[model samples]
Target: MLDFHMVYTCGYWSGSPECGLDDAQQQKLNLVCRNLNLKPGQTVLDILSFAKFAAENAGAKVVGITISKEQAALVRDLCKGLNAEIRFEDYRDTLGEFDHIVSLGMFEHVGPKNYRIYMERISGLLTNGGLFLLHIIGAT
Candidate 1:
């Protein structure tokens, strides 16, 4: 139920209805990178792999993790020759620290039972003053 690109996430229209799906997606990616203030040679952990490509394009060393084997393989293939690493692993098992962490549309799976654990894991993964951006749909 989406465009051919299969990008299932929020889009930044910038008040232009003429914007194509890919254009909107690119806009969102740029916005994320800008807000994170990513720098060259910095480390980034992209949980869910949504912003891996964008972060890589911004010259950051990106480590993207996905539980789905298919997705992991897809990202690896798509990001070939770029400073990006795609891993098929659960976030609970992730290692090392990151200058920035970005997770989109994946927190719904964390559930209330594992919310504390999830937050703790994220906290442990981040470096001092590291930025984390989480985008998820929820009811208030």
Candidate 2:
């Protein structure tokens, strides 16, 4: 059940019509890592995202925050022996600056009332020249 990089969220299916779920997930992960330019020993905030992948593949030290206990546990297990920490809490309560931040399909829960605050916090948590990758689904 944990195969295919343990992808539990949306995948990037924009490439290769013949690609399967694993390929799509790989593509999405690769795309994000490339965009963030993940590097060795860099600090990253994943907003409860693909931290294990980044920590393992890029040698990044990642902190992933989520409101879900299940997700936190799963990520903690997946990131075992890596430079990754999964926190179960509100993102607003998370502290510290990061070299890069990435969130995939999480902005939908930021409720309008807290949208501005959330964005502000994200900005505040970013170090100078840090990159942020926000991947969301468009409702049409």
Candidate 3:
């Protein structure tokens, strides 16, 4: 199982110092998810989610994917009592016919060479009116 300490330590979980980089990143992610206009009962895809907070907060059905099988299982365990489904798959291969898609701190793992491909893949999964919210960090 993947240790959630790294993810939970981020401000997204709750409290954190203003100087926390993780907090800043999570703030950006939360804003994007909220701006997506997620609705309850909607199918939401969370690619490479570590905490599944956005999906849970939206009160939507979630399909979460992680590259690590064990980590995916952990996510499944965490969401066992909730309306969430967790799986192990490369984000590139995951299927999504969702009303909303949210991903945070994951796109950076995809090299620039694969960024467009990743974007295209996610875009292809949306309904004509679906929204996709991505929180990415660019190198300074």
Best by lDDT: 2
- Candidate 1 local Cα displacement, residue 113, angstroms: 1.6
Per-residue lDDT of 1-140 in model 3, one digit per residue for the tens? 12232352224444544445655655645565569876778888877563466556667888887888887877787786778888788777887598887776787778889988998999888888998877666767
Poorest stretch of ten by lDDT in candidate 1: 1-10
Number of colliding residue pairs in each model:
0, 0, 0
Error of 2 at 67 (Å): 1.0
The CA lDDT of each predicted structure is: 0.80, 0.85, 0.70
TM-score of 3: 0.76
Model 2: per-residue lDDT, tens digit, 1-140?
12367656787787677978877787888888888888899999998768988998899999999999998998899899999989997888999999999887788778679889988999999999999888776675
Alpha-carbon deviation at 84 in model 1, angstroms: 0.8
Candidate 3 residue spans exceeding 4 A from truth: 1-30
Checking candidate 3 for backbone clashes, the offending pairs are: none
The alpha-carbon lDDT assigned to residue 87 of candidate 1 equals 92
Residue-level lDDT of model 1, residues 1-140, one tens digit each, is 13333345776788897998778877877788889898888889988645455545688888988899998887787778888888999999999999999987788889989999998999999999999988777987
How far in Å is the alpha carbon of 11 misplaced in model 2?
A: 1.7
**Models ranked on lDDT:** 2, 1, 3
